[model samples]
Target chain A: MTRNVSICAMAQIKNQPAIWQHRFQGMLMECFESIMEQTQVTFDMDTGLRNVVTCSDDVFDARTISDAAVTDVVGAHFRGEEKVAQDGISALGYAMACILSGHDDLILVMGHCKESQSESRNMCTNLSFDPFYSRPLGLDYLNAAAFQARAYMEETGLTDAHLADIVVRSRQNGAHTRHARENEQVTAKEVMASPLVADPIRQMHHYPVTDWAVGFLLCCEERAHEFTDNPVRLTGFGSCMDSYFLGDRDLTAHFALKKACARAYTMAGITDPEKELDLVELNDACAYQLPLWAEGIGITGKARGPKWMEAGGMDKHHVNLSGGMLNGNPLMLGGLARAAYGFTQLQGTAGINQVTGLQRALAHGTTGAAGQHHAVLILEK
Target chain B: MTEKTTAGLVADIFATMESRVIPEGVDGITANYGYIITGPGGGQWTVCVADGRVTVVEDLVTPDVTTTCANDDWIAITLGKLDGMTAFSSGKLKVTGDMGLLVAAAGFFEKYQPPLAEITVADIFATMESRVNPDGVQGITANCGYRITGDNGGEWTVCVADGKVTVLAGIKDPDVTTTCADTDWIAITLGKLDGMTAFSSGKLKVTGNLDILSTAARFFKKYSPPSAGPEEAPEELIVLKQVLSIPQTFATGPVMGHFLNALKEKRILANQCPECQRLQIPPREVCAECVVRCKEFVQIGPEGIISTPDVAYYASPDPLTGETRETPYCSCHFLLDGCKDHETMWHELKASDIPRAERGVRVRPVWNDTLTGSVTDIKYFEIIDD
Candidate 1:
């Protein structure tokens, strides 16, 4: 077996609806300074950090080279830096590969996004589609998720009430999670009463537009102790992208997610993920995804998401105890936030949401419309 | 060796004739195709299609159409390595009898696969050293590794140093390594699936020194399956062109309001940064350099000198109006009279003045008849000769 890569420290600013007062660079500097304070890491070429990986999107940032805007603030001056344009969790995966390849031992991973910066998040997502086909029809993430939600609901018998329950529980859990976006607790009745943004998807079901910045210091397992007493090893990482066209995909089948999970599980030597994983952090950008992704990851049988939700499978699996993405993380940073929370719980630093004996955890992130791309990361203590 | 004999390839092509027939494509078509392959390993065969059913005979008999080509060219055409028309026009392939039957016969069958023996991963690696292009690898020194998985897959390294190339089994100390499924690897090598497309969509994974690995494409000449000619598709690609647009509105904020309001009165205003004392044209709310508020405003340019001029030949559609502006337009940055150094404002010069547009040329704004608080309040800047 090759050497493992350990996340020595992770830091993040509070996720908010909008951080209009400060620029995105200022938001990222807080996380950078916090990671520096926590690990006391430096920019030494031979002994310390040499390479930096950042995750952000060009369309969301409205800048061609978005990473260039934060290179100075992230301390990437005259150093090797690469940007992962997908969800930030891929940065963790990329950093892991760098360490395992013996190219660089220590890496700084940073990601930031302010969904509020754009006039409309839907407009930004709409541009992600091809100009000739999908974009002209105005197919954005929300409407695309509605199509998936309707399909999953019809197949699994998940109802409006079940979606309400998911939303209410997310906020109730988020109340205890610091740095989580401040969402008012709502009753299941209130969630049901919320107006539909798209058919079968209510306004309250989707993650709110949020601003966030997070950083993690990663080092090889051999030198893990040099950075911190508590180190969370990234045992495995895998990502899979499905077809670009929504019509080409069976929306609720979890085609990409299943392949991604299978690859990660094999890498971690996990035969039965349901039996081995201590906790699972799913990037549920919407309420339906909570159960849909749960089924996708094999925590429950196919078409059994509704029954599993009623039976409290979410709590039993200890999934999204940090309120998941539903309580609000920006689009690009959803998985990174999940990984950050998983890192905290494994370190026993999760204040009220902490669970005992967390030895292994799964963090999943998704990108593109209707979950076209999925990444799964396995973290072990 | 798995080099297929032309006779065997022709027999296999006829063997799969019935199954490869498309009922819709062959509907209402009655024809017989006679193939004459000459030279060593050559043979003759006839394909009969009637009432949507296909049958094959050992020899050419009562044929409505006949195609005559060399054994090598016949094999090349079947494997999609050489264009049928190219060979026909070049007299490498000769056709007689009903020519229309050949045109209708094109869509009668599905694409042909040359069988596993025709191409394999092992064959690709074994032939790498011999396929090296001397001119392509000149002065290049790098170690490129491959980890091809699946039933026929194995690891191999290509060491190129001092203009010489060597292929080694198993991965050595590599500067870069490319990992892909054996099937995808073969497709990429055969030009079936694009390598960049495979890499982007995650079908192919590459690690370590991407810059070094990029040169690997040039290190080896194109791979041609044994008994197959150069790789090029027979059909021309179909292209669909379209123009897409969406309506959008931008908020100009208070600082922009201060500047655009002055434009209505035939004047130009720029804001001064209190901290840096730098002026921002079109008036930004904050000074980017000082990162402080710029509250002081000054009237700068109704006229200015061009600092940079770019004459554009390509016409991209305007986002606001969804119209393509005429070509030979000059987009320039102007250093206004009151502004110094890099505080230049960007705008387009009049189309007619494009020939004379140059840096240090004096220009003045041409206002629209009815001014609205927008960037287009000034239609364009015209060159002020002398």
Candidate 2:
């Protein structure tokens, strides 16, 4: 059986176009203190709260060994800490892994990314591919995602209209949340009229370049009640990686996500995921990804996303109660916001965007082009 | 350089020293500066800096640093027309005494005025086009108009598109318009002025998207006016580009060394994973899947089928060299006979064969005329009929 890791408390900065007043240190200052106050958790050596995991990237931070640049705010108070170096989901996964291994109980996880710091995000993603072959082609996430969107849309008979609807709903949902980056509601017509970023992916389809800092306090079930009366338990999580080359994988289907969610399902003791999971928060980096990944993770049936959309959205199945990635979450915290929102849902603290009678929730994150690496987490009340 | 008043260049130095009442703690070590300028128009003078005060005398004194130079050269150095370090190093100015006190002498003075190097507004505006940073102006299309008010001042416009710049004498419907004085514009053009200081001082006024004006700063390298004076003349007016080459030899590890050695003999090499039975071409030290050492050097392919072909339309500049390659080049991976799935050899394809650069396309290795134990031994791969 997997160990129960409760997300006792969490805090995220108010998502802004650019936090020009403060740098990464200043943004982290309030985020760290806010989490401490929210959880009422203290870093006492006697309590055995020993490690910290920070999520950041060199390209976004524009620094070598980006995590070391913010050690004072993230790890100065801890005895042993390490950086995950991936998205927030990966760091949260590492913290949970530590707890499950019977080594550490309480772990501090912080994630921050300033999208404005990069000259071009697509160029940074281009560097992720192998230098010899893929790197020379100058393919960034937008172009690669365009190919995926076209292929996936063609295969599943999904159109640009379907994508436009997703953005409309995402922005609408974001308006009801407190810390959403894009809150103003946009109509499907407005989304469709937006300028094209790539062939199929429009400007509205893309996540706004945002500055965000989010911190979390994870305590084991043994002392979960000490932090909060109702703690949202992070029951299970699994991360899987597929081929690096885009040409090597079938972009139409989520092959890696299948493996990732399967491992999580086995650990969480979840069978018939469509009926078992109550709420779903997906790392919809683009608008098309919401419905596509929804079907990919078995939240909805294959080729049934369009039908679900036509039948008045995923209301029958609660998903992205706090908007999701289309609402301007930074690249590093793309998945972190999803997991943070999932915790709020499970804790019944998801104010206006809360789903009624919510018991279990699934939060998903993805990295690399066309979701090359996928991570899935099942959180329960 | 600002215009100054004095009877002559030699007397000018003495006059400035007379008024150069020193500040406290300036004269830590007392010294005398003696100047003996010899030329068609030459003279001598002595400057005594002691006890935080400086006094000048027409007669020479027992000095620390006895600075000697030609009258013309000394005048050039004092007027900022010639670089002081260049004059000293090139033996134009000779100093035969304590050189340490020469540096300390600068702090002993209140201020000394240098002669102005005459420059016109036309000369400053003429070089504006050449000073722009081509790379920085790339992909930007805008017209920046300038209006200079004063004698020798006129209207001008700079139209920039991508990396190309066109400067016109008259106005073009501009995005960002700037207004400044002729003196301020010339000073700014000659690097004698700071843009921010000029803006704050109300000498330079800019009206438009202030962002465009700020970006305009990046649109150009520091503008420097040409100096007609022999002392102030730069080595050249036009830029001369050169390739800085540093030869280096990198050590190839045992596995890679073996692979390159095999290439010299016109043979291919692969490393087989004992665990998965899968082979890696361009042989790796360890199998990526099995994570174990693979010492076996098995031959894989002289010919193979293209698995993934990338026909690049853009040429990303090599950051190290800043040189961009010609576009429409084909970089591909070949699925050799022994290797299946994604395990393939990464290499370039012949440009002529780019149309056929696709999956399932058969290709053969095209080796160089003379084989060397290097990765470049195989020039590229060419499409084969069968």
Candidate 3:
């Protein structure tokens, strides 16, 4: 990479179902202040923070151009600001692009989502479908994922029991995480017996609805050292979009994720993902997605997710040390949370969730129904 | 021949076809035709002319040829003012099913006259795309939904792409959706009722992006609100009300379930983590400090000391249920027998204990006569002088 973008600082509040006493702006302000407090990066129109990138959705935030809603909190003092209405991880890719393009140097990336604000999160997701085909059929992310899960399970012969194991590990891992929603570990029996939400998928199979916000300060390599002593460079970024119609896609295939990872890895000069990367922080919105997405990103072999999930495999592999997506984190902000956790891991400030010392990490996030679009990033210490 | 609607125009074409002239240079053509005239005055009409007999009906009859266009264009085609070949040459008139049949159908009708222009609320929406003023939203695409109430009770979806607007009949996931009474909407559009007045009076409700809708107003040509008639305000208004019932259930995981169930036996249990020596009064799964699972369940105090107690002078209303509990109640946290300081469990203290509610005060759980496996099984904890 010509000019590597490094993360100066990162901060986030623990995932909460609702923070009714205060507004979302306050939550974002706290994250903003915390990041500034760590890096001491001030926003000066002359030579400091230049542009801001925000990850938000009109439907999710119940408003359009949602970045404009958080101006006072994030980058009102900057030279420019742009909002990406996709998943949070995608905004990181966009911010990196802006820096590489020589358009801006220091960029503040903030992402937030609150599932507690809406009556049902599914209602917001259902609207993402094309009104003609999918919306008429009442398709949402959960049911669409159920279709993918069923197909993926049928193809790999994965069962509901295997899903329980993933949830148990996710919850157990979440216990050690700083900002996890469901921290208590559960047995396979409890997870399997949990109420059936979308057949073959118990309630525990999906990510819990949470309210969270995260922020990161990024700058070029030279500018990075000025901000922080320990700076992790963002070497590669790739994002791709797939078919909008669920019928058009092969339910069992993570072609978009694979293609995105291929582009990102190629840029980072990565030959082997499993061997090269020290840790992987991925948005596993559901338990099924963890292994399926792991395979999608070329980490594990086909149908080998369960094997890699064996008691100590994740710790050995250094995956989702911040408990990953399923334990908590809102939908749009899931990827950003993953990136925040990854940044913390590389910075060696992950506290209890920190794994064995590492050098390289992959952060990933997906958007749209049934993972129609995927984004990947490679950060190095 | 003088009917004002597209249906009337089709009726006149069929009436002219009844006498039927194949033009001096044409031959007897056996074919069916369908016309989907657009705009506010538009509708579906079928024209079938076979062996000198002509039939026209107001329905979508899949025919040998179908021409979809605006109502005015169809009228112009019938009147021969807009050349049939020219309309087809341009994209203004779209022909599907069979191309040859359209020319044949054009020859099927004779000397028809175009009618006067008449527009309606429906016309504004149908021709919305044609009225786009691209300058409104430089380079943006957004969906805006319309839900009209009272008489014109129907839904419409409008998609504004780059500077053009396309309107359709039904709902679309929108950037901003607006709901308003039909009368108020018409009054606002036609320049009769003030948009702000309608909005303030609760007649217009908008969700999603409010700015998008404001920008969308400039996307189209200015709408002329209908002229208002003399009106008088009503002295009284009736409000409609209805009751709703929603059932909800919550999960109390294994740890909390054990704590609640043990209440029925008048026994209190707490879990102690091996990594952390401190025990929890109410058994929980993982210890926050150690991040380790705690399975060692030890019986906590039926009798314990009060770690903290807040005797409130006034009751705080439940925000959700909108109800208030009795005031001057002492809400206390107890450090159960097995649990140490800082591992206190919270519950309400008995009314009599409110006077002595303070730090270092000992309390004991008061069990109800009816043993139910729930939190309510134990009444308020009473102060015990030890």
C-alpha lDDT score of every prediction, in listed order? 0.87, 0.78, 0.77
Best by the lDDT measure? 1
Distance from true location, Cα of A238 in model 2, Å: 1.2
Best of the two (1, 2) by TM-score: 1
- Model 2 Cα shift for residue B69 (angstroms): 46
Is candidate 2 or 3 superior in TM-score? 3
After the best TM-score superposition of candidate 1, give how far the Cα of residue A367 lies from its true spot, in angstroms.
Answer: 1.6
Query: Model 3 residue B184 lDDT?
Result: 74
Docking class of 3: incorrect
Worst ten-residue run, lDDT, model 1 chain A?
Answer: A20-29
Q: What tens-digit string does per-residue lDDT give for candidate 1 at B193-302?
A: 99899999999999999998777788888888875644664576655545333333333446677687788898889889898798888776555444345679999988
Docking class of 2: incorrect
Can you write out model 2's per-residue Cα lDDT over A1-381, one digit (the tens) per residue?
Answer: 556788888888888877766567667756877876767666577684578889988777767798776666664443676887666898888889888887888988988887766656776777677666676787878888889888878777888888887888788888888888756777878888999989899998998878899998888888888888888888879889999889999886779899999999998999988899998889988887887888888867777777767776566677776778888898878889989998888878888878888888998988888788899988898
Which model is ahead, 1 or 2, in terms of DockQ? 1
lDDT by residue (A1-381, candidate 1, tens digit) is: 578899999999999988866667777777887888888887777898788999988877777899987786687877889999988889999999999999989999999998888878998899888887888888999999999999999998999999999999999889888899999999999999999999899999999889899999999999989889999999989899999999999999999999999989999999898899999999999999999999888999999999998898999999899899999999998899999999988999888988998899999999999899999999999
All DockQ scores: 0.03, 0.02, 0.02
Q: Write the per-residue lDDT of candidate 3 for residues B1-386, one digit (tens) a residue.
A: 23334455645554465455544413466677888888755778777666666677778776877888887777777665677667877988987765645544545555654344443557557757766777875687889999887866578899877666779887788888899877777778767887778878998999898988777667777653222111444455544332222221233456667777788888888888798678886665555444345778888788888898987643444556644566557788888776776888888899887888888888888988998877778788998776
RMSD of 3: 27.6
